[model samples]
Target: MTLDYRWLHDTVRDRFDSDDAMEAFLPRPLTPDELKQQGDDRYLSAMSQRVFRAGMKHSVVDAKWPAFEEAFWGFDPEKLVLLSPEQIDGYMNNDRIIRHRTKLQTIPRNAQFILDIRQEQGTSFGEFIANWPSADIIGLWNLLSKRGARLGGRSAAGFLRLVGKDTFLLTSDVVARLMAAGVIDQTPASQRDRQRVQDAFNALQRVSARPLCQLSAMISLSINPRGGLKFQTQRY
Candidate 1:
């Protein structure tokens, strides 16, 4: 089915009180050059942050991230991969961080994931992300979900967004907009639905020439000023 970009644009534009307001609501994603320049350690840090961020307040997680960086040796994959299980379990005694043992355990595992990618691709994690085709971004999400610890579903997408990847968010409002546009019948909780959502974004991009980040925010705003978040029980 063909999407109505005109309707989407007009609806979003109508929702906002002014041009400045509309622009402020849009997301500013990192350029390819900027995305590639970020260090692998930062990616690891972001991945960990995104994991802990689930079912918790982002502000609390963000507030303690500096301690996490210091605690995890600046999130260097090599250093983290070397952490012994006892050392991982020992984080429970530390008050500087969240102190959740289950979540903390993912650090080493995800570090190994990062290392494997580095060794396999022979590039910084940022370069790997930057080089990924945004048109097939769902594939990237799937890969992250499969390889990284606790990086399933929105967590995978959240990590990508945290790192300024140019991909659309499947927020509640965005999904509603997509459904209304005949893009999908329901929340994109399956790979099949996700592919459809991706295809729709690609179609929208072809006409708008806007990055996925901005388009996603616009699509969400088209339906509502702000939408409630709903995490899926199953990974897409």
Candidate 2:
């Protein structure tokens, strides 16, 4: 049966504009004051990536996240580089996140690549992320394809776009929400792109507020099944 996506889109549109609206539509994370407070930490970006990965593992692919986490060193970029070939082979045979060998092998190299960018750019991780360089559709697609190391190419791209990667204009839940809200016609295939579109629509609606992390949680709650949104739920 075909799924209707209008309600999901509208819900995202209405809530993302304001904290209260978002809270009313979803759940609470950081209070208003906390969102207002800022530092040089890339905690939000890191958390967003984690959420994207976990969501891909659990919701999209029905994999065991806990095992994935345990096997992958908490998704730490630095630690991932240390994994041996045997470990990658083991992960392939295990019943965890997508066990694609190429994806697994790419983890460490990808981590190293990011680290190289971080050093070469002379920017903090947060700053580097905040200034992601993607202008058009192709650029965004390439950026996502590259960043999503261990995830499948299309899935990685979708996840990046969903989590507000600056290049693309798609996101899974955001597109679903947009479809639900009647703001758009077709459901975007790329989750990341869908999210970008939702953010753009939210901006047009004049519902801007601080604390995107909190809003992220709200978004997750609205779309993800119960117990599926928690970051640490899948204990390693």
Candidate 3:
């Protein structure tokens, strides 16, 4: 029910010889105020980027971001939400941005999702995301999936992580450790198992007072040989 911070720290430190690697294992998430202050455009850009990252190389996707910014009108939720169906369809042949029509379509659909949350909640989209409780991050994930197009499951989780939210990723390595720790029997394919995993991280957070992402990384590095994380650095 409890994870030893010392053990997690030492476990990772023993593997990565660079003294700074463990210290930088996970990016420093923004404070609530910082989260609240971000523009919705940034959120849209980050969300769209995650969608592109799903099927392409990070370097390739990143290199095209400048064109994406231009093509999507700087990811302005209000503006994007108003794009015509024909206008969205028109991007299918555009070389300036990723030509995948479905991914291009998420731009306008997710833009509307952001605006809806702002109007319904009577706060900025950033504020709405910032106000979400970290302990109930799964709840936030569910909300995003239910409301935003192409944001279900892992896409929702990736978006949250990109926006500097405090949450854990159920990566393969983390799942392996979760199984080893008796948290679950296998990959959390069912909602019930996912909830159980969230509860486990919630408990560990209560005990260790650590960020969930860091805990996930620690769990990832906790398995197998000491040098397992040589190529596993997570970028912010």
lDDT of each: 0.84, 0.46, 0.80
What are the TM-scores, per candidate, against the unseen true structure?
Answer: 0.92, 0.46, 0.90
Error in Å for residue 28 of model 3:
1.7
lDDT of 2: 0.46
Q: TM-score of the candidate numbered 2? A: 0.46
How does model 3 score by TM-score? 0.90
Clashes of each: 0, 28, 0
Candidate 2 per-residue lDDT, tens place, 92-188, comes to 7876566667656766666665567568888544454455433233444455456545444444434443334433223455346456545556865
The collision pairs in model 3 are none
Write candidate 1's Cα lDDT for 127-232 as tens digits: 8999999999999999999999999978888999888888777888788878887889889899899999899889989998988888887776677654333322
Top model number, lDDT = 1
In terms of TM-score, the best-performing candidate is: 1
lDDT of 1: 0.84
The lowest-lDDT stretch of 10 consecutive residues in candidate 1 is 227-236
Sort order, lDDT high to low: 1, 3, 2
Q: Determine the C-alpha RMSD for candidate 3 after optimal superposition of all C-alphas.
A: 2.5
